[model samples]
Target chain A: IPPPMRPIPCKPLFFDLAGNHISYPMDEIEEKAGTSKKSPKKEGGGITGLVKGLWGWGGK
Target chain B: MTTPTAAQQKKEQEKQALYVELQKFCQSQDDTRAIKVASKILHLFPNDEVAFKTKIVCHVNRGMFAEALSLINDTSKLSGSVQYEKAYCLYRLQRMEEAKSVLDSWQSNSFKKVELMYQIHYRLDNFESAYDSLSDLLKTSDDEMDDERRTNLSAIAASLKLAGSSRRVKDIQ
Candidate 1:
């Protein structure tokens, strides 16, 4: 009997996500709750906190 | 008996505050903090669905499969997605039989469930079931992941046609 040829590799999933690791669909839980990537509305927030968080203005 | 209205409102407000914190932790991808906040929410409101889910997902992201599985078992009447989580935890724990059992009870033919089924079967060396799952994925897959799915399908078919698995490539095809 002839030997069967080895198969090629499949495309990678998730591409090295830090926490999720693989394409585990972990975010589906948040998405269904209408909460994925969206922060709860904070009161009286303008641009100060955003800038500080973005560039570490005060911490650095 | 009903509680006083003001107290009830205060409790509601408290729950909202914890839930909002949980949401913030999730947004930041601070999974450990998310788990802690979610545990707080669940302690306060045991029936909070999103809190339960958030905690479970955090456990998984941290590779705490055993913890996630224990929590899933202790809870009652899990949602379909949560049931999938249970199966996933079992699979990650390398308990293939229990994982397959959980998946066998799954009613919906969701893409996630099918993909997981394929993985579990593959891990158990059940190539036939894996082949069938890949076929199902091929039939229902969107363009977003069709290429990967096809590659997996061909790989499974090729391996099965060999002496390792009894099923022929033509049989799976």
Candidate 2:
């Protein structure tokens, strides 16, 4: 892995949620390292664009 | 005492008993019953931490990767040990990049370094490196693993053998 490819370690938000690391895109994350099969579903809202739908209305 | 009131009380008692049993099952390392119990609990209290984690672990163990991933995404109380379990589930699913990202961001040192290296190498099919790194990890670690870790080590060793054989066969072909 190149140094440039290394994701920066920092916490960011996905719309309403807080403390999520917003370094790389979820697709890139899935491509490079892979993802869990039952990933969280995106709620019918905008925040799903952020942390791969880790936060949304459906979670509740 | 009215019969209806008695029946309601019994139902509540049953629910409470089931909840206690679910908690016990969640704490136990036994995946089979734990999964069943957890799933039942989730059917009742979907956000319960123990139940959610147990369900995710069970699904991942069963290779229900898509279900496990969806649950991980949906549940919020799986904030601690459950997160580590989710990471392992991700690895089993072959979502290496997401697995790596989650593992990297995790607060637990347990999933760091060697496992990450091995996972990366495994995803890349760099079997030699994966085996060597895991072997190195066993060599360096001071913690004594009981039956389960030893069993996983055995499996990794066997896979390494198979990987080596296949590589050789490929060369011959």
Candidate 3:
């Protein structure tokens, strides 16, 4: 058996719609987009919240 | 008992009609039409989960991950599958760590989750773990393994075996 490998710190590579491989600096993108710091608050409430609670049907 | 006002009845009928149209569009896999109907429904009922989910699927199918992510972010409450979809968007965007973190946060046993985990582990160069995940997935009944999934498992297995043997040969040399 091959010895266990250590996890390497590497950036992930994404594919575009054209099936081209592209590398992105996610940390910088997140920092600039403000997603790295905090998530946005969800909108609406009550019946909307209740309705939005259903799962696994159309979104699959 | 008080009867619904004319306007209320009209609104209810419209909602029902929109839902019917949405279902038809989705069933036909007409994502563009489905999205349009879903957006209309969502506009009228912002919290409609089915419409939101339909819209998300349409965006994802079109490879609009950024749009899908944005929609997921706008939602306050996420259903299990929606969370999975969000993680998938992250994974497709090449935010592997973020994708892993999201999947980790959710205590799900979905095949999609397993597949995503396998991909993430493989990309992270954790071949052993990746192989283990793929093995677990393959162990699912043959009926559950579609042609594409079976092919993917075989390909990953071959790649892992090639890597392992090459490493061993280097060690021997």
Candidate 3 per-residue lDDT over residues B88-171, each given as its tens digit:
788889888998899889888866677778778766666677667766766683553345555555555555665663422111
Instruction: List model 1 lDDT by residue over B1-173, tens digit each.
Output: 45698888777667666755766677678889988877887787788777787788888878898998888888875444488788888888889899899989988676677788887776776778888877877776666656666666666666566526766564323
Compared with the true structure, all predictions reach lDDT values of: 0.67, 0.52, 0.62
Model 1 segments beyond 4 Å from truth?
Answer: A1-60, B1-3, B77-81, B164-173
iRMS per model, in Å, is 7.0, 20.0, 15.0
For B1-173, candidate 2 gives per-residue lDDT tens digits of: 69999987675455455645554544454557767766765676555564565566566556676877777776655645455556656666777777767766777655244555465666666667655666666556555432333443444555556556443211110
**Which residue ranges in model 3 land beyond 4 Å of their true spot?**
A1-60, B1-6, B78-81, B144-147, B158-173
Q: Rank candidates, lDDT, best first.
A: 1, 3, 2
- In candidate 3 the C-alpha lDDT for residue B86 amounts to 80
TM-scores, one per candidate:
0.69, 0.45, 0.64
| Candidate 2 Cα outliers beyond 4 Å, as residue runs | A1-60, B1-16, B19-36, B77-80, B111-113, B125-136, B142-173
CAPRI grade, predicted model 1: incorrect
Best by lDDT: 1
Q: Is candidate 1 or candidate 2 better by lDDT?
A: 1
Give the per-residue Cα lDDT of candidate 3 at B46. Answer: 79
Candidate with better TM-score, 1 vs 2: 1
- Rank the candidate models, highest DockQ first: 1, 3, 2
Q: Candidate 1 recovers what fraction of true contacts?
A: 0.02
